[model samples]
Target: MKKVPFIAVEGPIGVGKSSLAREIANYYQYRLLNEIVEENPFLGNFYKDIDGWSFQTEMFFLCNRYKQLEDIEKYHLNKNEPVVADYHIFKNQIFAERTLQSKQYEKYKQIYYILTANMPEPNLIIYLKAGLNTLLERISLRGRDIEKNIDPAYLLQLTKDYEQFMGKFINDHPNVPVLTFECDHIDFIKNKADLEAIFSKIDDQLFINN
Candidate 1:
């Protein structure tokens, strides 16, 4: 198969985006670009006290993702390697809108829109969907120390927001193919059959279109 130029997998917290991106990259020999949440100094603090550090954490992520996208664009165009990124730049805004106030969202939106205006969109976007209870279970199993106190209600709210936002985004960008998978009943990372099923869906979406 001639490689698709770019692909991205995105979902809410504990949805295994990085896992899927890495697995696909390894499988297809694409360059993997994963988000660096572990490297973000403000992440722990933000998780502990979102009101105080939400803007700081979001701004840091926004800038960091922009840089990654810029680097990916230049590198991929120059060297011609298919690219698989775990998250999209817009995902940060999905969180920011929920965490930030109206004024704060307005301010951030101005900058985000300007920066991403001409950015390259992925050839295919694979979106994972899971129920709130499933999301909480995954979060607990992952056991990130900072995430121990994460409110299930907050996650539920974010899940709703993600669904709405992704729904609208996909509607607006009709040319961008989105493969939405409900993850409430399956664990793609741990279940071999589940992983194969997801991969098969991806293969068909990416290859059959050609």
Candidate 2:
């Protein structure tokens, strides 16, 4: 089969995945699919008390993302243009693993794996990397109310897990090209040059016109 006409940008919170996704979508004139965090009613409470609302939050996101992927799959089957999504569906498992107990994780994984059986995978995945301090600074700069209460230690752990997951992902799926960018030295949000560099990466990896 030809490469899937989909691009996924992924990273832990405070990295510029969403921004880069939006920029790529606009630049390429592709459909944009964003993670629907704002639509989830349980998200605020989940942020405030992860132990209390973790399951609810994760399930809500899993269902929402599955629906989005289903819709995107249908769209792709009918069209040729690419789609740029901020978060890949697999990242939901990352959150669930972090939040759920052993039994809960197993149960959720069974359901998630079944639902995503025919889902479309990205042709190119852009994984953003940032140090804990830089992530903290970006998180503070964003100024989301729920995010203000996020513990620094929790963010650090999430970062470590993200790194491990991406490392394993690369090892297991060598055919799927992944471009990793470290955000400590570059500010794509404010610098045109940085944005151009990111666009160049997308072009080189996905567009085939670089």
Candidate 3:
């Protein structure tokens, strides 16, 4: 049997990161890993009062993500099974840093480092990029009640932070291949050709073009 690769998809909210991750996992018969987003007890309140509930929300996410990664490591990585995850574990730091206060962020960083110390990293990363307006439209189309009132300013800044985080990630992990796509013009969710194109890119970046 061929060695299965671990793939991860990342993007700002409503960029169809999860949707595309699902497509890839299905197409390739890889294990699909979805983030535990709405499960965080403090998430709803964090959206209402970011400053007040940020710590609780971040901590909850940290613990959950850590546990998820541990499970993935033991169950999939150890077996060499292919895996595709909607969100990489490292993204925990990006949100925590952006949400938590300085002192809180410092403490969060310490915890993040410890949890991530022995975690497995993805063999390939797919970053879906879309314009702010495009993301807003998609967000409305999805119609999630908790996300309806997301602050535009906060979302905008979060998008920027994601881009910056990817930049630094690329610099830090040069061996890991990252394939970025400008998905504003393509609808991978409904367009088979578009999805195939992304798959081709993944192949090209991580295999063919490597």
Q: For model 2, name the residue pairs that clash.
A: none
Residue 157 displacement in candidate 3 (angstroms): 0.7
Regions of model 1 farther than 4 Å from truth: 1-4
Off by over 4 Å in 2: 1-4, 207-210
- Local accuracy of candidate 1 as per-residue lDDT tens digits, 98-169: 999889989999999988887877888999889888888888887888787787888888989999999999
Model 1 poorest ten-residue lDDT run: 1-10
lDDT of 2 at 43: 80
- The C-alpha lDDT values of all candidates are 0.86, 0.86, 0.86
Which candidate order results from sorting by TM-score in descending order? 3, 2, 1
Top candidate, metric TM-score:
3
lDDT (tens digit, per residue) of candidate 2 on 132-175: 89999988988877787788888889999999999999999887
lDDT of 3 by residue, 65-149 (tens): 8898889889988897778999988888878888889999999889889888978888888998888898999999988878876
Better of 2 and 3 by TM-score: 3
Count of backbone collisions within predicted model 2 = 0
The count of backbone overlaps in candidate 1 is 0
